[model samples]
Target: MVSPDVFYGALTRASGRWPLSAAARELVRSGVPVFPCVPGGKRPLTEHGFHDAATDPDQVEAWWGQHPGANIGVPTGAPSGFVAVDVDVHGPVDGFRGFSRASRAGLAEGWQFLVTTPSGGMHAYYPATPGQEQRSWQAARAGIDFRGDGGYILVPPSEVSTTGAVAGYRLQRFNAGASSVLDSDRLRDFLDPRPAPRPPENPGLQRQADMSRLAVWVAARGEGERNRGLFWAACRLAENGVPASDALDGLSAAASDAGLGEREITATVHSAYRAAHPTREDSASPTVRDSSPAAPDDWFARDPVSRPSSVRGLG
Candidate 1:
């Protein structure tokens, strides 16, 4: 498989209008297998979808000749030497935020270029690991999808007809940094993490496992209640003897999935634990014994005056 950098270099150098037929042939000549999708759409024109991708020049010529305007489909992962992190923008969900979170976590990076999809989404192409097989996955809630092994992507110069307008996939930008293989597994985990493992034999861990529902509830918390909800849930765990660190471990990812920032999640969990078990300095208990006195010297014992003498005007 040719590196994406090399593939892209040759692809851009090919001169022409890059019409469907010409672009298909050019991809074949550049050593990337190609397939046809329905004209102005994503559904495969061939019977087997991406499995029909071929590098043979004659097959390429025949397919494009028959369907002159079929969109170009390139198999990702090993077949094309690259995988894509697809950022979907739909309704009220903007995947760019989730992608940003992944990038901050050092998961999604080193892409060849960003392809603007017809529906205004983005496809970030990254080099695939040579020997490793990274399967594709979709985090629907996060609005991000991975196109790796067993998946395909529509490349540049392919147009999709939406409503009434014809919008084409275009190169948004090229990455100047060193392009490296993305860890798709890690990226998926960061975006939409799985639930904690089943209950373990250890009693403490077993108890923690039983509280996984709390984490799920926290993740489902919406805008106004996210922080307060997480704090309340964490407090329940802490009050039941769940360690602060364990609470952090269990709730951090869930709270993050619910749209809480890392720092806010940490602080909230710690706050819950603190609230569950207040510190000596924050305790409100009386320092002296309750039975010690109610005498003049025991003014301290007189129900601990609700107001200072000066405020009460007691001379």
Candidate 2:
């Protein structure tokens, strides 16, 4: 894999007044796989999205030859040998403050390069740990996203045109100091801290706290795992002695935010409840595949009464 510094250098050379096709070719030549995105936008132009990213010069040439204006998209983490901390800047949802807090906590330094995104946001680049698997996650409420494994980011010079206005990503700063691999887990915890479930003398307070954290976890789940995550969280609540109704109520809005419908959320919660307490009294057993006995150490696994929970981010 190409080093982060080499990747950043290639990107810098390709950016600024270079044709989009030239930029795409430059990256593939550096052993960085890249794909074409919609002209002036972030949407993937290919059928399989970032999965179609390729390092082959001919493949990249064919792609850009067809759409010269397409923006360059590179998969993060293992595929590109780098990860990104995306600080978003949508209206009323600036992430700089949270990023600043992370930096103060000494969790946001060691970035290889800082790129200014089209929307006036920031994408801080960091080298991927050589053999570690860091998955992607979004702390939407925090207005930040970690583009690690299973995620992609538009490289410098990619433009976004909205309402006839066009803006491009630009390399703003390069860190000449030693670049370090980011501990995505630590950064996430610092950005959106959740209390570890504990045995409480105040049971009511404990339930509320656990449910809140679980709901936040559900809310943060990304596509392809929303339903499964909700089920796991609901099951955690059930295993912790919380009622089914409360689980539904606690996780409803969060599930909704994660793009699950009312019915799906309701069904998943009920299924989880049944799975947690499979009694003959349950007239109809849940048949959903998610209800199939999850191992104690599955994604977002926890034994609230015995130990701390370990939540997995999207991958």
Candidate 3:
């Protein structure tokens, strides 16, 4: 068996070329699923997006032939047997600081490949655990995100338009012969670190009650109500000082029980969390509930600002 170190070394060296099309072909040869991205943009040319990623040389050649200047995009997650930790630079939190914190917490130490993005972000590549179906997440408060199942990332040598603030993406670190891949469990732990135990207090009990109420509210939601309900619940959770991971875990399960798909639940909850907690600090919790019965459409049409001050935080 080819050792992991040897495989990573070869993959890293193979990624050094400038021509994206050629690089795409090389990645395909190396067993990494790849597809053509729109020239100077992140959108994939394939109709099915990352689902169309393939290792077939003929298909890759055909894609590049049609769009010679297209950029290279690699699908992450199970398809490529890897996940990417994307540390972005634009948020209030510093990406490097968050990464350093994770490292200090004993995570990401085994990462073997790194890429610098066009927007001054970093992408750390790690091998995916077999049969694991991790999903993309925007850890906005921490300035980091995960690109896994159902997501794609543009690879090095792929340049965005110069009109943008960033120049382009480039390869940074590659252990030419490293024998290990980053542990997905460690990465997940870093991303969703367990909350430290808190002392028993009235506030903690109150928060639990609030969370249960929110979960019940989410569970009561039906078709066309998932997104709005999740957004509202997430906002409430943020107000109650619940951590994002905890809130996502509880609310996602409730959403699933309400017949919402994983994708919808993830997107809705993340968006709501970011909107609710624009800063790292917790917002005031909503105490009043609108008890008036109303049409589902009416409830959905109401602007977030029209809700209680605490709920309006999600706006």
By descending TM-score, how would the candidates be arranged? Answer: 2, 1, 3
Clashing pairs in 3: 5-178, 5-179, 9-176
lDDT of 1 by residue, 1-315 (tens): 876676776556532366888988888888988899999899988877787788999999989899999999999888888999999898888999999988887888788888788888999999889898887777777889899987899987888897799998877788887888898877866886544444357755556555677788688866655786687677666555555676788888999999999988877777666665565233222122223222222111111001112212111
Shift in Å, residue 175, candidate 3? 3.7
Compute the lDDT for candidate 1: 0.75
lDDT, each prediction: 0.75, 0.80, 0.66
Error of model 2, residue 96, in angstroms: 1.2
Off by over 4 Å in 1: 13-16, 197-315
Best by lDDT: 2
Task: Write the residue-wise lDDT of candidate 2 on 52-83 in tens digits.
Answer: 78998988988999999999999988888899
Show model 2 residue runs off by greater than 4 Å. 195-198, 202-209, 212-232, 238-250, 253-259, 266-315
Q: List candidate 3 stretches off by more than 4 Å.
A: 1-17, 162-166, 176-208, 212-315
Per-residue lDDT of model 3, residues 39-102, tens digit only: 9999888777777778889998999888888888888777777778888887365787888888
